[model samples]
Target: MATPDALAFRFFSLQVVRTESLGPSLVRVTFAGDDLAHFHSDGRDQSLSLFLPAEGRSKPAVPFEEGENWYQAWRELPDDVRAVMRSYTLRALRRDPDEIDIDFVLHGVEPGAAVAAGPASRWAADAKPGAEVVLIGPAVADNRAIRFRPAEGTDLVLMWGDETALPALLASLESLPAGLPVRAWVEVPHAGDVQDVVTAADAEVTWLVRDESSAEGAFPALDAIRAAGLPSARKPYVWLAGEAGRMKELRRHFVGERGVDRRQVTFVGYWRRGLTEEQLREQPQE
Candidate 1:
């Protein structure tokens, strides 16, 4: 790990510095380490591969000795020993002390939750100070992991996301140029899950709580966005993510019905209904 490749992604060993309950369904975990001196990111929707320690293990079982081949090496380990890897976005980054915050959605961890708790969710729910984890993140300030690319001439921005995409959406909003027009929508399971956002962008954000009327697979936000009509912009960038099935519907509505340029739309399926991250990874990417 002495040299960073052209891609600029490298492994960093970090430990939990603190954890805070953001809401009923969200938890914020802050991590720091000496290795963080090398970590850098430009922020908007930056993706990171987090490796949590396997159950009963002290630290994540990452094969750092294998260098760039760490992914394959770690995968070859026994299921019980291998670290649990999950994708997450950087909620915030600070330099003075070199710390990063990641927001995790705690599904099924709440009292009498309907859904089941996944490993990552459970890890986040009970995370404590000094818990060690490994991260595969950008070493360079700007890398390919960021997806919120607003075209130069864009006059307005359109964004949509569910709880899973909340961190990315908020980070993107915070990074946008001041006074930029932004129309954003967020869907969360509980009203208590709503977060107060701080962004310089001239943004109008709406939170939609999922209920019986609006089922999991239903793209209810699409209808609301469609009814509001597109903001007046010659060139507007659309970024929508979370819940594969619903995200697809939003993309279709923007690109097809409203005629937003497909290229200008950055749509990502952060996760899908009833599918674990591992299962989602198995599906072919668009």
Candidate 2:
């Protein structure tokens, strides 16, 4: 398979072939399609955009042939028929039978609410074999969405993420150079959410399972990181992704308190508290 850098964004129609619950709240959905034969992923945190159909629709209605301009064309579609677009990491990919696996964090409904699952979460929780969706992903392996790059001479990797980023973090861990030093702090809602994470790097992983009653504003991972001394490395790359507010605060802590170079740390707000993905995307960047 070609690297993402050598490929362009292409559309593919995929059908759900299987679904497995990895943990208390993680659902792994496997998709299969002929177009996947041309799909290439550089692995480590490879991201893709998925367009899911609204209720009653078998598949999202979007122009697949528009190539890079599909966004504008998709926006031009009637609102009711347009698909809900969401970004996700490619948990695993295989070409022999043209299949890709994506793990979705099934955050349960809010307290006292009848239904509170987001579009993607709801879809994953209820998805069955044969359900179809449209994906705007790489036709070749080298697309630019892979974000786990580390600078030259960097021997230590620091990672922090919530449940939503666990798949990507695990993928990055698996791809790390052998014997490299890595310290990761992962936050999840429940202890059962923790799973076995395999990696070749000399890794010290700390799982922060928050109390069920804890509010969204709680920063368990940040507290844990503050207590654990930073890894010993001259050049360290810090990667963080999770709730927007917490991520921003962590970014400030790393840069201002820890004196890490601003450019050496990569922080991504995978989601935000009290906001939908669309709303979060509309906000101005800090």
Candidate 3:
């Protein structure tokens, strides 16, 4: 996989170096490669596109066309022959041996699972040290994909995310300056999904664990935020990412009800309720 196409972004040939079970529904995969020597990112909420090998393929088939033409060329390949593409956020980046960590939400891999696991979930669940994957990532430390940007003189920070967005949420939280007033809410399917949040900021984190019987997990952050009183702030920045529809509702609560400036609120739709990643990719971005 060689896509030296775009200037800021390029393809990095990588393989799994280790895997760690973060919880019942989450797995953290660490990848390393010689190409990673050029990988650079500021890391907070940094997005990357991963290409995984199809069902019986040994390696992913990616087009190397320059500029945006690579997308069309990739789509032109046969469905079974093309790579399975998915989006993920960089959980952490390291030097010394040059590696990156990505956390995957194991959708339907467990026994008696309600939903069927997708290609990425299945691949992640069974990933071994030598499993290969390609990453379309930033070559510049300050690329446009890093979205958690707080304006100057921000007095307080507000954040919310679901299991799918946990990696990005945690990365963003860790990047905030020490002593900044922060409040965060995260929703996950199982109680085991909750992890200790370590940040230098004066932060309060609330975890919402949905019943195990619930398949997709209920999003209660909107109602929770609506009912609770937020800390007083001259200027507050809000960051919210999770399901598309739920994020819209939270964005409304923050801007329409809480009276936070629309410009100061940043929201990302990590996934939709029922749509597959491929299906969601076809829909225009919200």
Candidate 4:
């Protein structure tokens, strides 16, 4: 598979064309823009950063004309005017219509609580046709951030993801070669969040419905993975992404307890339990 280029980021102004609910907690939003002609995705687990305008605003006021160094410009803006930026995977890309589909997890408001909703989730839940946003993505198809590169002669694939990483996991499953041995586990909040995933690969996917009543810091999926034995294969590639803390423990289990070669595993911490993406990024890397 082709790899993405390094440091290739471009800005595009896109408008929402349609919206659909994929499951109980997932919303699919299709965006279209004339500038998308230059947008090319590497496909498997490709991700991009999005800038959403504040409520009641038609479009984000980003000073893109200041050139590729928009990050500094975005930061220079006053707190109230600056847009809220977040990262998300490109669920699907269609060049025919010059559009892209993004799946947003709908974290509904808590009943009888005064807590503020997540900016991205709130925006997605209320997003409508013609809603405009800005995306910092790749101009070329092979730009990096795809991240699902398996080495040659790999015999089996092991995957695990939480609801936040579901889009990327599903995308990778759909692209695997036919009849390839694959086992995947996806954990979601409810059984209704499970959706039929179409893939050509001979893959067995287990849906792990989370127990919300459980005490904090519980790692049910990690426990389940520890209880199950890995499939026999000469060379197995493991890919893991989800909550940061849980993923760290899983990495230890696979590399230390299971004796899997560290080089064969690709692990990423998509998010942390208590920290927002911004806060997570601020901390030193582990």
Best by TM-score: 1
* RMSD (CA, Å), each prediction: 1.8, 3.0, 2.5, 3.0
Model 3 ranges off by over 4 Å = 1-5, 65-68, 212-218
Error of 3 at 123 (Å): 0.3
lDDT of each: 0.90, 0.84, 0.90, 0.85
> Per-residue lDDT for 106-155 in model 4, tens only?
77544553445688888998899999999988887776678887789998
Ten consecutive residues with minimal summed lDDT in candidate 3? 211-220
The TM-score obtained by model 3 is: 0.95
Candidate 3 on 73-191: residue-level lDDT in tens?
88889999899899999999999999999999999998888788999999999998988898899999998899999999999999999999999999998998899999999989889
**Deviation of model 3 at 32, angstroms:** 0.3
Q: Which parts of model 4 have CA positions greater than 4 angstroms off?
A: 1-7, 110-115
In the predicted model 2, the residue pairs found to clash are 3-141, 3-142, 4-141, 4-142, 4-143, 5-142, 40-141
Model 3 steric clash pairs: none
Each candidate's TM vs. the true structure?
Answer: 0.95, 0.92, 0.95, 0.94
Tens digits of lDDT, candidate 2, 1-286: 6345435767789999999988777889999998887787788888888889876687878886676566789888887888989989889988678899999988764355444788788788889999999887776565568778889999888889999899999998998878999999998877888989899899999998878677856777788887888767888898998888888888888889887888999887888888888888899986
- Candidate 4, residue 225: CA error in Å? 0.9
Preferred candidate (TM-score higher): 1 or 3 = 1
